[model samples]
Target: MLTPGDGGAGPAVPVGTRGPTVQTLATGEVFAALDASPRGLASADAAARRDRFGPNELPPAGRRGLWQDLVGQFTDLFAVVLLVASAITFLAYGLQKPQDVGTLQLAVAILGVVVLNAAIGFAQEYSAERTAESLQAMVPHTCRVLRDGERRELPARELVPGDVVVLEAGDAVPADCRLVEAHEVSVNNAALTGESDAVGRTGDPVAAGPVLQARNCVFMGTDVVAGAAKAVVFATGAATEFGGIFRLAAAAPRQKTPLQRQVASMARRVAGTALAIGAALFAVRVPAGQSFVETFVFALGVMVALVPEGLPATLSVSLAIGVRRMARRHALVKQLLAVEALGSTTVVCTDKTGTLTQAEMTVVQVWAGGAPHAVSGVGYAPEGDVANPQPVRGLLRAAALCCNARLVPPSDRQGWRVLGDTTEGALLVAAAKAGLDRVTEEAAAPRVAEYPFDSVRKLMSTVHGDTADGYHAYVKGAPQELLARSTSIDWGGERRPLTEELRAAVTAANDELASQGLRVLAAAWRPVSDSRPVQDEVESELTLLGLVGMLDPPRPEVSDAVAACRRARIRIIMVTGDHPLTAEAVARRVGIVSRPAPTVVTGARLDALDDKDLDTLLAAPGELLLCRVSPEHKMRVVTALQRRGEVVAVTGDGANDAPALKHADIGVAMGASGTDVAREAAVIVLLDDSFASIAAAVKLGRSVYQNIRKFLVYVFSSNIG
Candidate 1:
């Protein structure tokens, strides 16, 4: 239970008490719980709720002031030791019978070294913080809400729980809300879930499971891509899921990297050993009647000599150089110490989309006419060879006709650009690659009506006028839905009644494609008496055209990167929000999981396991995959791995991935596709969002450790002289 301060602008709502339960309850029940109505809250009641609930803005991330940052630079243990030694040198010089010029020179030099060290560290820290501030720039906005039966545009900050907000295509959802009424509403949850697909929402209530998967709800930070809906706001500000993630990210404590801990330990040991040796000399000489001023000066000189005067500057310079080299490889290091940590990384927990996979969806296989045909080529390019295109032409043509996406020819600056949905664009590109142009298909069977895909039916249909007098409808959607509506099949260039056996075969085919991690869609068609307003009946008793399976292919360089990680003895484990089959397939494709069937854990199963059980599973030798996991699950896994002395690195590109990114020893974020929340939480941002960059960074980081060792030897040898 989160409240206003989750990250947003107002007073935080009381924990577990203020959030209204909207998803599980009936619409009427929800309205009663919030004391809301279709007409909306009366002006007086709305004012009171606003006052009680605080502002609707998420709390801003706290930033350290320049003064605070500078103060921190001087607080390092090494710097403190040098400062103390410098002060004592001045005291010893003053107490001497005759002022020693050499002692005065030593004190001035130590002060100068301390100042120089502080300056270098402060510059880098300030620069990194300034860059982060650029990423945090935000703007306030407005939303359309109904108040006392009148719809008005108000600041998004003014939105309160129980406000009925009208969502249209292209409008950002103002708050987390339960749908009261929906008309083909579809939302893009990419910001919140990291999945780019448009998910359909309904006004129906669901009794159980995660609210993230609730069909009756729409959440903040999501954009309405199609249709319209009236949803009642239930959560706002930090209380919303969007705000909750950033809150967790900000709240998660980042531990000191191994290198940082080791450096502090070394500094303490060196300072302590030098002081002990100097103290023994003073104790032995004092009994022999040596002057106090003489012994004090001698002890202070020994301490100064033992200290690594140039080490701080050299180390900062070395790490800064590593940052530059990593940038060339497409990784930006936000934390200077992360360079050393990357080299020591033993376990990498990565997300599926944008890291290992190219994230560009392409059609690879088509099942039609009782035979399977493989489509060649990659991305949105319509330049693939379709094996036996003539047999599958009908399926491709009908699928193209039913889609609303358009493809723009390749321009000098960019490749083909998809105007509408990427899934539909894939269908259009598939048709073109098979020599079935969209214009040609449309002219032959011009569409007169369309039924957009919705959460309920899970299918979209378009009624088209064919060469014959009657109208024909082309439909494409979830394979199961289309299969249930289908009564006949296009069997190898011939029409046949779909027998029970044939239906079972079709079901098997769909399952086979899905198990291979392909996004499968079924195509079907039916003849209608007239091209009047399209209705649900128009999709019934259709002819099953077959299925097309698409995949977000793994990047060409990921395999080599995986091999590099293996050679480095870094265990790569995939943790994704995708389905288990999809996660495993991508894991195998990228070489994260080599086993034929790995021990895959779903989020639900993970939730049931205690810490000891989780640790046992993770310690097992076989390939491990976790799918359908939430941010908490990811963070939990990172913690479990760390408990076994593994230095973990987690990669992510969505708001949901923020907490894990913050909690991990190394958080690598995708700069291009990652949400701002994710980027803010990560210490390393990959410009190309490639697993290869991470491998490259680790290589460069390993060199830093060698550089440190070399610097230590040189300093020790120089001090001996």
Candidate 2:
């Protein structure tokens, strides 16, 4: 049923129909098949093609109308039981005692409770659904493409097959396309493949592989990270690789929350018990010389009393209050039963970014002139100070000059914002903390020429100087790369010749920082006599300035929340798309894994395990950390945990997280950073994207379920009295 290109705005393509394999075909052949060229489709032809292929977008999800939602409110088991009880009471009273107004009043009151509860539930659900739909509109809606040989911006929905789309760093790929040209292109396929690392793309055709892995192809929903590319759209809308995932997620059957299942079971047992009691009373009283009408009336009263008529209303009020309490703590509950599900959560499979950490990179330490200086503050805000700024001034200057990212001053209510990569932004912030102004520094020693960072070199260099300094090249990149190229190091305001011992010491320092889960970047500089020296020549025999240790620091409140989870008998497992070292470091910092040598599983290792192996792993786990895992791996882990009788809660914020979010007992999505698809699939959205909020929600959820049980006990006990 999920056949690609089957249903859309244009003519339907029959399932199983074959066409030219786009990836295997030459660029010219692909262009011919699409009726397009390098010049791109003319306006008239583009319009016709648009009409034929339809808008390139996922079909809007069908929503339940107000009327349907109202009807749904009365479809619960308790509501149905109340309706039947009212009808039976009315019939028995009318047939046996037409003059009795009390029986009629009782029937009328029971029906009123049903109507009132249904109306209240309907209003709450209707409002919540509307809010969720409005949030979905916030996703990116436009992209750049070529039309009639001129580049123009257009709504992503209007893109069709044959369109020549342009992609740049930070741009989300709008549709599936084959690369016609690429310039050091690298894409973050986290949304599609769940790999946090950026993948390099090429225009050259691959001989054989899965289409998603082809070097010349780019799929929808992924973002370009480090380069530019011109790709010809070959698959649009639901026909793309992303669409297959969309269909898979859409088709996945929604399971009943644990609360719903338990509630239903309790309702069935209570109903059966009430029926048998009523029947026994009728049989015994009628045979003991009581009038038939009197016995029937007595039995009716007993059934009504046992039914817990106020339960529906009480449950609604309790859940509503729980929702409000969670909202105050920055967790928005989308479904009432999800609150109860959260209470029962035994394992929380949380992502590292935005959940455990701040998700904003910050420079915490700088090693320069043979001493370590700590940098204060945690985000883009330039309010922190560096310890001993004077000694590290050149190091900070080099960090600022070698970076391409810019920091925009706080505008309106917003604080400092980064215009480039977060890691680079951290460097700029560090420079600011060290009393270096990038604008002033650049003006004094303006850039001449530069070498941009590439996947192969893993380094970036910027030449900035006058004729006096002879064009000093400031370079920053992976510590290993920079250290290998450096022949000397700055020590105590003096340049020393790089010796074997010094090199080993630098390597040891880098390893120490890395072991602590910090991302280390080495800064070095060299004099380039040529105003425009070649990158390879300009990067050699440089003086190493020092190393900068940065980290997306763990949220200050998460450690307390993790401790609370432990106290509540809940196990927190970190499943992330980040590297093993980074994930392990964050996990240890957040207290998710206390042991120094916790089990860390990767996607590759997960793939190698069978279901039995996975089940065994889940069973034996003291504390589990899954790193560099894809969405499928997350879902599998959730499923395996469920099979072991543990209630699971999954937190995520990407398109790849949608399926697992839907599959979990309670899916918690990040309201601030989550994709539209992820938000739609989740049961709860953390407005602040904090682990602390999730812990608070669990506490409130437990209270909600406890209150419901207390109300049930009070109602049943009152009926007995």
Candidate maximizing lDDT:
1
* Segments of candidate 2 deviating more than 4 angstroms: 1-35, 96-98, 197-199, 410-415
Candidate 1 lDDT over residue span 1-721, tens digit each: 2233465454555343233345777788777766689988778877877886766767766867778877887888877887887888888788776888888898898888888777776776667656655654542368999998999999998888878999886578888888989877777776677564578788888766677778889888777766688988887787788888888898899878888888789889888988888898888887889887788777767767877777877778888889889978978788788998998899999888878886667888999866789998877878878998998999999899988767888876456756556688788889988998789778878889998886578899999997766788889999999888888999987889999999989988888888787899999988888888457668898999999998888888999999999999999888888767777888887888786779999999999999999999999988898988888999999999999999999998888899999999999998866777788888888878888999999999999989998999999888656
TM-score of 2: 0.93
TM-score, one value per model: 0.87, 0.93
Model 2 lDDT vs. the true structure? 0.81
Q: Which ten residues in a row have the lowest lDDT in candidate 1?
A: 12-21
Candidate lDDT scores, in order, read 0.83, 0.81
TM-score of 1: 0.87
Alpha carbon deviation, residue 318, candidate 2 (Å): 0.5
